[model samples]
Target: MRRSRAADPRGRAADRGSRTVTLTGLVAATALTASLTAACGGGTSTDTEGGNTDPKTLTYWATNQGASLEHDKKVLTPELKKFERQTGIKVKLEVIPWSDLLNRILAATTSGQGPDVLNIGNTWSASLQATGALLPFDDKTFAKIGGKDRFVPSALASTGTAGKDPAAVPLYSLAYGLYYNKARFDEAGIDEPPATWSELVAAGRKLTKGGKYGLAVEGANLAENSHHAFVFSQQHGGDFFDSEGKPTFTTAANVKAVKQYVDLLAGDKIAAPGNAEYAQNQSLKDFATGKAAMLLWQAADTTLKSHGMKPGDYGIAPVPVQSGAPGQGRNVNSMVAGINISVFKNSDNLDGALKFVKFMTSDTEQKHLNSTYGAIPPVKSAQDGGTFSTPAQKVLRETLATSAAPLPQVPDESKFETLVGTAMKELFADAAAGRQVTEKSVRDRLAKAQQQMQS
Candidate 1:
């Protein structure tokens, strides 16, 4: 499932082509540190003891980005072996599932018992950086892992606040894409993927029949729901936060977006009635099983193939925009950073870990690993020269370049996820249960959620 969440293989061509936004400042360090400590339910320690003192050995925790843990090991062993041969450093790699990664990371940060290097979801980068538990990539440290400019600007921006040394660097990059089953489209007599929200609904109406939904959605997973909300809000020319980084979930644009999202089920009835309980995996399964005709996802190619859906069965396109909105038709997309690499501050093998980081992002490794995982490589060089061989990868690269924005980089990002996601979940529930979800009702719910954040 690491591959499912870590690198969906559904979106983004290359990180370099993505739009970049500069996030200027961070919440006060003291407050951020305290927030992380409280959230993780752990106290930080400065202990650097018990680390492998041998310059030849390093520990790494890799997210499950392959078919399985064993598959990841098979893919990574040779690469690590190559690194050892060249740098004389032996890496002990542990492939962790997405379900256990965050907890394990918290335990390691609190107890100083963890790998020297690890992969984390980029969305968690700022939250983890606030803990002061990550080894930051400063000027000196960055020099060891190739220069800062070697990374994709947009990908690097997700690692930390602008003007601050980031605690991680983008490893694999991703972007959102509209995935539609070609067979289903043909069956429905649809000639092309929907280019606008209205057209999408119209197509959905045609695609929905014989117990098959027009679209699949992840309503139960708050994180995924929040991601969709972010995209919809942006398409409506609204964002979750204001210019000052304060929550603005109840803005008119946001309410409209949320209403439109909920209307897909409540008003349009294009999605399955039971979809309110669906998570990302479940929705993806529904799509794979032909229960849905369209899905918006990123980096899902390998997983889709594993699910028995071949590349030719599905087509990838940019997510549609609101045609009548202020920025309608403007290229805009969800905030997506596939997976990022971070070094622990308490690692006994800092030098070795840095070496591994550099090795992982190197052109050769980037190409090999990303190719195996069916994801976009974060390095510019790896993406050029026909490195992305598939049509989906090519489409994603162009989408990232023209669209893609990162989630808000506020210190309270997790709070935003919980609040906005929960609100969306409630809306979905209301729609699923045949309740009315008017504009005022949506505004009221968002207002309540925003108040909870402030409180």
Candidate 2:
């Protein structure tokens, strides 16, 4: 969800507090993103046994955030400098925005000019792995990085596998939830945020008023929009994919959920006007500014701070579900999200890069990442010690307790999400226009997308 950017005095003070805590947290977190002093178990250098001649140097590329290279260098340069002092190796670092990352990687693969090590979004693991552009890490490589046992199984599972080889190592993790404005709820006479789909709609109706939307969303965000749709489907005991990983989103439960998704803007009239046109960040912006009362988004605690909202002013809960579902399933499904670090197949500094990846995923480093970047740790132990250290953390931790599932980990995931979302958008527009959504339309649309996925 987007965070509201209102200039509340108390909210401003809360923002300062968040920054202070984050700065203090970075001392511990920066370790995950920074330097590596320990040796990796798989220590074969192309410079030696692999018939290569070059100085011992490693190049790293990452999407910028958490800390910029300038700030990262302050923390990591010292660590790399120390590694050089101890191991006689040098490291170079570069940052790229996410928008250009994929094209750049594809270009590098074609030109044979890719960095020795690359940080990738977890969602892209399967796609990149399919290209055979990354070196698959074997047991020996895991042992070098302190083994698979050191990381969270969920994070480890996100990286693709070709047989026994791991395509990448997770660097951080994310999950989505509902972020509500506490003051708005109070004003609307809502004692607590709704816990079921029916109650949520009721709450939205009560809260929306002149010039304010009860909820904010961006139907145009095809990839992200699917996250909400899937979550609602799960809450209603539905599946977007059959056991064979084929599309099955036309189920009755799913149709109902899709109607709910559209009803926020259409029937209820509680969503921002022109919401269908907003992009990913716009909803977040609307929510942060108090233009919307509720939002469904991922790991927004940091952004909440930027929008001048605080923990007390905001309440986060698991995504609400159908009135009565099995497991008292109040929460919808969630996906594990994060970035993964991997070595390029043709990297000359394999040993150095592998060592660096391990250092980043280690418990100590994971702790640093949690503290510094406000990102969840990919290592289970490190996450336990990290920033999600309060009752507020429980809100997220518990929400994920529901059987949250991820998008299909397939090479065509991006295309699949796009197709599914495009179909959903058309149906959603109908739902918004007060047309009764039915199983026929949902099923027909899904079947077409499924066929396209197979093709």
Q: Who wins the TM-score comparison?
A: 1
lDDT of 1: 0.71
lDDT of 1 by residue, 207-265 (tens): 99999999987665566666667778888778998878888999888998888887888
lDDT on C-alpha atoms for all candidate structures: 0.71, 0.59
Candidate maximizing lDDT: 1
Q: Which lDDT tens digits does candidate 2 get at residues 112-210?
A: 566778776665566566667677878888888888887766656667733446788867565556789988898888998777767888898887887
Model 2 weakest lDDT span, ten residues long = 3-12
Q: Which stretches of candidate 2 lie over 4 Å from their true place?
A: 1-55, 64-90, 161-164, 249-254, 324-332, 425-448
